[model samples]
Target: MTKPLPLALFGHPSMARRAWPLALIVALHIGFFLLLRDGLLNRIVPELPSTIVTAIIFPPAEPPARPVAASPAPKPPGPAVRTIIKPRPAVRRTPPVVMPPDAAPVSAAPAPSPIAELPPAAAPAPAVPPQPAARPVHRATVTSGVQYVRPPRPDYPAQSKRIGEEGRVVLRVLVNEKGEAERVEIQTSSGHARLDEAAREAVQHAQFRPHMEDGEPVTVFAIVPITFRLDQ
Candidate 1:
């Protein structure tokens, strides 16, 4: 006779106003199941030092490869030292003093010539002015007298006379023992890059005349050609 609990139905005010919205929906589902079992549920994560998290995610194991020392066995060749060179005892030559025919005529005054230690005269080397002979560089494929005193007035490239672009250009000139044009080499190329660069700028501004043979001024390689004759 003592089991009448259900709060005795709140003493029945219509069964406590119908159990008060099922006791406020069972106390709001037991306070949201104890606030989701005490915030977000079942999470005991504070124990991470598994050996400092396996020493920061596993990297401590490479110390075992130091054993390579076996190289000392090569000493078996010691028996070849026989140097006995001793054959120099035959130089005793002193037997020619038979001067008894007078021996008194040895005062000719020429015995004082031993003062001849002459090795100090080396200062006359400034007279080296005789080197004028290396002037024969002859590659003149018959360059007549190698004449052109600045005759390369090439300005004809009005795009090579409006593209007529003629031919000749030979050039290989290097003619320079002071007669200038010391280098201009396109031996025969006037198929026309503006008549071969206007005959290589008229043999590099041509001033030749240095290719003589017995009259001296040498350094030749001439072979000049250069026509480009669009009728001129």
Candidate 2:
């Protein structure tokens, strides 16, 4: 019990060599204060120098533009689509038959002479001879007269005998079958057309003596009265 003083202080070799150099100087001062508290906790407060706090976040104010709703006025174009063209069927053009390049065959005009196509046998019915039953004959008169054979006497138009212009003209002559005076007619108008054209050129150069009738020289009509008198 009393032998436990460090085993009696190491059994006392001068107090065990001064207690082993004072326990190796308190264990080298507790290992140099635990390496200066792990070099002042590894001098780490300098980590506070990492506070570069540039926090300038200014971006949040854009929400005031909601007024865009006026787009609805385009609806008025609805009735124009008529494409109906159907009329193409009339092509009957057949007129091209002209084959005459001269092979010498155009001789068909000689058939018109078959004795002039023989239609002339119908001319034998022209023998009509029965027309003579109503007569009371015996008419020879120019007032029962006519006998001149060239009597032409009328020359008074020296401007109607110097304008005294007298009148009487009747005329109407016709007389032909070769007895002459063929047609002279003023049947009565002598208010003087130069004394009715000098009494129709003196009864057309007069020459009349032909009124025979059944013995044939008949063409008659003769009323003559010509007189333009300037005292002569």
Candidate 3:
């Protein structure tokens, strides 16, 4: 007899109906996974230019330094040249003329007679007037002859008196040729400006006899001492 064909080749009728839904579910899952993978692959970014990126991020390198040339030293100066001067020849002097021994001596010529001289005319004497005698010059030291026509005494400063400021003020007075005090300078201070100024004013107002030199009035400087005593 011939071998029978297997019955498994022909599927069961009830199992076929249940297998259709499971197969459909598997196909739908495979299609959804393929769509997701394709979308992720499309979103991937390309690589950037490395050279442009590096230039923007980092600074450029500096160039190498160049070598410098040295300066040349100056040369020393040469020795100076010597010069020789020639001496000039000496000048000769001519000798004076000399007389010969054989020549005869010459005689001198005779002088002519002098004309007769007339008597000199007499000149009349000029009349002379008697000259007045010179006046004697008398010089006297000013120590005793000086007389004051106006004697001024400084008024005691009320402030100085109240303060009991007592001292001597020496002043230098310049008396002119007119016997008037022309200027007054303070020689020594009385420790008070007011007292010193008062003394100067008094001396300026006073009149004095000018010093006599050769009987002529002359300007002189005299020291006048003023005593400022509060008690007196």
Per-residue CA lDDT of model 2 for 145-174, tens digit only, reads: 567788868999787788688888888787
How does candidate 2 score on lDDT?
0.76
TM-score of each model, paired residue for residue: 0.20, 0.21, 0.38
lDDT of each: 0.72, 0.76, 0.76
Q: Using TM-score, give the best candidate's number.
A: 3
- For the record, the alpha-carbon RMSD of candidate 2 to the native fold, in angstroms, is 33.0
Candidate 1 residue-wise lDDT, 51-158, digit = tens = 543445788999999999989999999999999999999999999878788666566665555676789877766666677888444665545555777777676778
User: What lDDT would candidate 1 get against the real structure?
Assistant: 0.72
Quote the positional error of residue 132 for candidate 3 in Å: 18
> Model 3 segments beyond 4 Å from truth?
1-146
lDDT of 1 at 193: 74
